[model samples]
Target: MVSSAGFPDFTRVVSKTIHAVVNVKNFSKKYSNQFDPFDFFFGFPDDFGNNRERKPQRNDIPGLHGSGVILSPDGYIVTNNHVIKDAEKIEITLNDQRTYKAKLIGTDPSTDIALLKINEKNLPFIYFSDSNKVQVGEWVLAIGNPFDLNSTVTAGIISAKNRSLGILRGETQSSIESFFQTDAAVNPGNSGGALINTNGELIGINTAISSASGNFIGYSFAAPSNLVAKVIQDIKKYGTVQRAYLGVKGIDLSKTEYLKVYNQETHQNIKSQQGFLIGEVFEKSGADDAGLKKGDIIKSIDGKPIQNIADLSFIVGTKHPGDKIRVIIIRNKQKKIFNVILKDLQGRKKIRTKEEITPSELLGAVFDPLSKESKKDLGIDYGIKIKEIRTGRLSAIGLEEGDIILSINGIKMKNPNDVNKVLKKYSGDVTIKSIKENGQVYIAGFEMN
Candidate 1:
């Protein structure tokens, strides 16, 4: 498809895919008290000069603008979670300039993908391509809105695969970072946009750019479509991602310096220059059940070569609990193959529904919104009561029954649902402000990761 001048013609791909890319706007919940031009130009209220905070109505201005891809004809849209994160309202504008309010269906912070639904029907959508077949140097197109420019299209080639830049650290500690690296000119407003191949098939979702000056520096990353599809399907079916865990902590052998230190500390010379070296295998984990152990080097999965942690993570991430994989590893310089079954976070082999995986169930506790009488007694307007504590994170952290949860990581817990929302999306640096059963204030901090 390369033209005479050596440029692959992008006309056909852009024409079909551009229409499915929509503009996403995140509206702020409250307006700032900063000097308002309207108030400055007109007569102010008598209390304008008072040193008090006023809860203003919703702001009309969008706090952030990004691009999203329409994934289904019946109004399913997909975009980066950060694009609409914390927004009081989400607005979607189609290519025809028809705007509609979008409802957030679900979000998977680990993948940075969110599912949205609008009321309209019979819309254009993009089809998912086999991202596993996407190769380096393949021609591709980046379609999105950048700096308010609608339906902008850019051309590039896949520069690399299975790249992990740790750009998703803010999303979650268990973040999946395997991405397709490209030089596709993605910019500020391109997050949640489409990264399609020359055949007009969606290969990835453009998520982040690696740059120091906040502009494209010939490096952009996308969450591969294979993983995106799995996440979307889970969200649609279960209202949350059915994340599977391999539960093995290890070091990538490709990093020579770290490998050398590991070799010295472990008192062994691991000469292999590539693959992931297992440092610890959690008990009762899939890897442990499959007979995988410490000091083993993972060489492949289902015959695909494992070059680093990214490769291993990506292959495992695309699968759900109860899925089986063929894993090959090197143990004592001898190759060994094992059939491994993945497990969910609760170390179960069955898929869990939203109710089964609730924050209360995961934390081994029961929560309820603070009673009116309790709120009046504590002189607090918001708190979630831990009605009972079982063997979960709360109990492990010393929180007991009748404890009141005021906040986590600075976010107020107004109800049990608020606690679920925060815990579902966040990991690492857990700080909980609560009240003990004795009416004394209590706070607990720990590293969840």
Candidate 2:
């Protein structure tokens, strides 16, 4: 409902979605700071690990009072990954004030969506709207528990779409950042709220805001319901996201960037420079097999025009490995179309379900082969550095971020991919030879129970 001045009347929409929205509280006991204040300032031996559950010296405890949306009538809910991350306890408060301890079903940190389950049944839920059909300037109502106040509704229009804010890029190697931009007043407690349309359908999940004061300052972002819908299904099925990869490194281009390129080059004449420019193609990649090459410009995919990297990510992130997509690109000033099959980060054309794999088989560490310079410096010819420790069962078992893996079960690791291949085929007890940054070497052992 809209008035003459364009401000929407969100009466019925609020009534439909308010019950579905929940207030999520993530409680945490005080933890000793991981780094010693004096040591951190003076560069000495520090408290390297966070010892949580210790009695606090003061009363400053961390708490997360966020929001969530019920996705089904049987107590399934959706929220942001950061909301419940590392939470010792998750307490969900319904509209009727009934509280339940939420069970973490799964989480995709790249997309920032988490699925939670409660024992309650016959709960009110909201259906997802076709976010691709959502247009700019369409009226939207954000319903949540802002500032810990329940059932708050604010009306605004969809300010933009396919917004790439670069918030999720550092979270993973394959982060998706296509967000729906809106002007709704969102604050600290609105992290996982519902963004609904005029018909009261959930179009997006209010996740972030572009603000300097840590509060809503007219600009906010949400995970589109279309991507959310796909991720939720993957989480429920595979216990993780089946992120498909096109396997091409590229640069998003504009006319301004095209002009800069044209001025720098002393070669043949170039034109039509408003698309993604493929800079490199990895070996044994989907792009390589699809006949894509460097210097090619991707124009569209599956009849949809791609404006930038965010658009490309949104298109590919919704798909599974082995799914074929038609890619259109311009090569040598000529338009060409090729059918390309997507693959996962493991270079597998097929994704193995969670039930078919053990928790230890899933190595959650991103790795980089030790460089020649590094190998020469360290006096080691076979090793890989743990670049980032992603969330998994392995990470929980004391795997620090900077640990360099040398071997597993006496099999020397030569590169980043060597460990995964070893883990994929091996079974039973898991043992790893690793070296710390302080030149201390140790063996980490665990089982597949």
Candidate 3:
């Protein structure tokens, strides 16, 4: 007799989710043609000449295989960015061994979500759940193809949320992190898979795991479906994800104890407390244009208390460019309200395309204007010497303070404006050739996100 005093049965839910999961196999081929004198003289088994009665054997190149969930019945699927990154070919195999070639629609490296399309109709798909309502310790399932071991499913509860592992992708780092942490056994081949609730609704996308030997070590992270949905919608409509930016630069409030000495030295009477303190404001930026000055403490955004840098980032990220909102700040022990119009980090009213790189957008190292003294010290005629590395794209790439940028992609950069112009013309990877004071040349590559 079957026992009736058990928890709710979830077998049917797992069965339905399994039908929507598919195994992705990426294929590639490499051919080598070279003349070997020793082999020709010794009578080799295979001939290298084109006229010979032999053909090159087909080489199977196994790429980073993973899993994907069918998002729609018309064959729209969702997967991870790391799974199909740099893949020359993508093949999707169903549970029935039926396979088809998939086309890449879009990818967001910051959240590690990718959209793929295939030519099919009426396919089984899964629905997304309200990830915001999912509580920690709730039952969830991680479905994927681990180690090529077809369609494996592991069950666990949510461990934590809003995790920052410092995983970066090129020049774009995810400032909005509300990850659903779980102890699911996610592995290499399971990168682009689904994390679902007991109701079979997709809540998160399995992305990474914390392991020492490349195996599961009781820690895994997933991109929340809320963030995933936004990135997918943006990529599908505009071919890229657009992010809203706050104009002020500030350190995390939790580290105020260690920064008291520096803060006191910079501004007298400005107490180092728990909140985002404005360090520097860009000229004519959204915050600057709204009369926000340095040394002001950001108390909250739209009535929500500002906790740290990430908290402010998350609140700002939810808004779009040109959206107006009220910001509460504490300046000199006085509470003041300011109405600020949000803008993209570049102080632009809208998101820019591939051909727009302004001086403010080139956030990285600060360059000193061309002067006779600077030119004599750096031994460069038509280049700007790096003065201070503030905050921006270059600082994330390990650009030091004394590194002098001679040219960008072979175009001589005379000043910061010239460097921005050269960078704006190119859309993909841009190379920077820098020279040190002691004459050591190093190459750095920057990719636009």
Candidate 4:
């Protein structure tokens, strides 16, 4: 993959992208807690009750290394959310050996993207290319500080397009995993590195790899640059990600997972060649408001064919709240298109302003009311399911992501607002009854602040 005459020379690309790739360090001093009420959310528990008799431990995170890509000359940098999650301090080292502390602007854990800013100006940055236009088998380069080796470059061809590895589920409930798969030799410390084309345009962010031995195994994935660009724009415009939702839970028609849904809903034999079928729709959501029913099959979005969840995410994930989307669906052997105005998770159109921001807004989580079928299955009449948890007070309180909140201080929790309103108003010990992913019900108490 060297530069040569009469061909796409990658040397020009390496020269342009290498300057924007930088090393990232996450510093934290909190001691790791030894608890696992819910095994998934906390790598280690965030809290261990009010006991203060334990001895001080070393920093939970120190000298943790990763990679970042510069997005602007004014020092705006983009990296993976996991790279900076729970970081007490962040440091960025440029290729020229200049180091500066970075300010975390905001993060979209759903997309596994984070935006950081530094005080420096006139910094080298990279331009984003239309990831949609990137074809499979295109020449690409992965640049990062892999294995603490700064300014490392690896070359490969894009092996596949629109890949979903279910990597983002743990960080954000609304996982968007439309990744571009590559054979580049990515490894540890390459989480937020740049994936660029031969033209020197950023095509994706090198994120994760599929390896059985904890290293690259000829397969890797990257968050598309188009989505990263949209995430960056949202962080700059809104304080947090203004994720617009289609609000329906279903399965891809081609997968075996859709059989259970098909049996339960239609009670018919598994038979479908194409189109995504809806199993349930959230109330008051754009899909529900647009008259999209559970039995409907999604045909396309904005004239683009919807082949799978990744395709759906690529289109809707880039849109903001209050934006209108045209959804084409097939219902009872009829094709229909509905113009739907996407709304925030709260089913509202208002965006949070700086002055109006509150702790609830800072609570990076999404809450959905328990469906009747869900309540019946869980043997709970009232509760709210936490769809996802990014960061904020809820996460600090050890509220495991995706756990259901059954009650607040012995009061039945009905909807998302109840959890938000209580967390916003109460400042003391709050007891919560909830259901875990393992179907175990338990009670937890923690301070609101």
Ranking of all predicted structures according to TM-score, beginning with the best and ending with the worst: 1, 2, 4, 3
Q: Please write out the lDDT profile of model 1 over residues 76-117, one tens digit for every residue.
A: 999987787545568999999999988777666677787888
Query: Once all C-alphas are superposed, what RMSD does model 3 give against the true structure?
Result: 13.1
Reference-based lDDT, residue 132, model 2: 93
Name the candidate that leads on TM-score.
1
* TM-score of every candidate: 0.78, 0.76, 0.66, 0.76
Candidate 2 Cα lDDT to native: 0.77
Q: Compared with the true structure, what per-residue lDDT tens digits does model 4 show for residues 65-123?
A: 78999999999999987777656668899998899988777777777788888888888
The per-residue C-alpha lDDT of model 3 at residue 80 equals: 76
Residue-level lDDT tens digits of model 2 in 357-448: 54433455678888898788889888988887764433423356787888987899898767767766454566778887767775555433
Model 4 worst lDDT window (10 residues):
36-45
Q: Comparing candidate 3 with candidate 4, which one achieves the higher lDDT? A: 4
Error of 2 at 120 (Å): 0.8
List CA RMSD, all candidates: 10.7, 8.3, 13.1, 9.4
lDDT of model number 3: 0.70
lDDT of each prediction vs. the true structure? Answer: 0.81, 0.77, 0.70, 0.78
- Across residues 77-189, which tens digit of lDDT does each residue of candidate 3 receive? 88976566545467898767789988766665555677888889989899988776889888888999988887899988899765655453332444455577998778777
Q: Kindly indicate the candidate among 1 and 2 with the higher TM-score.
A: 1
**Which sections of candidate 1 miss by over 4 Å?**
1-6, 30-60, 354-378, 385-449
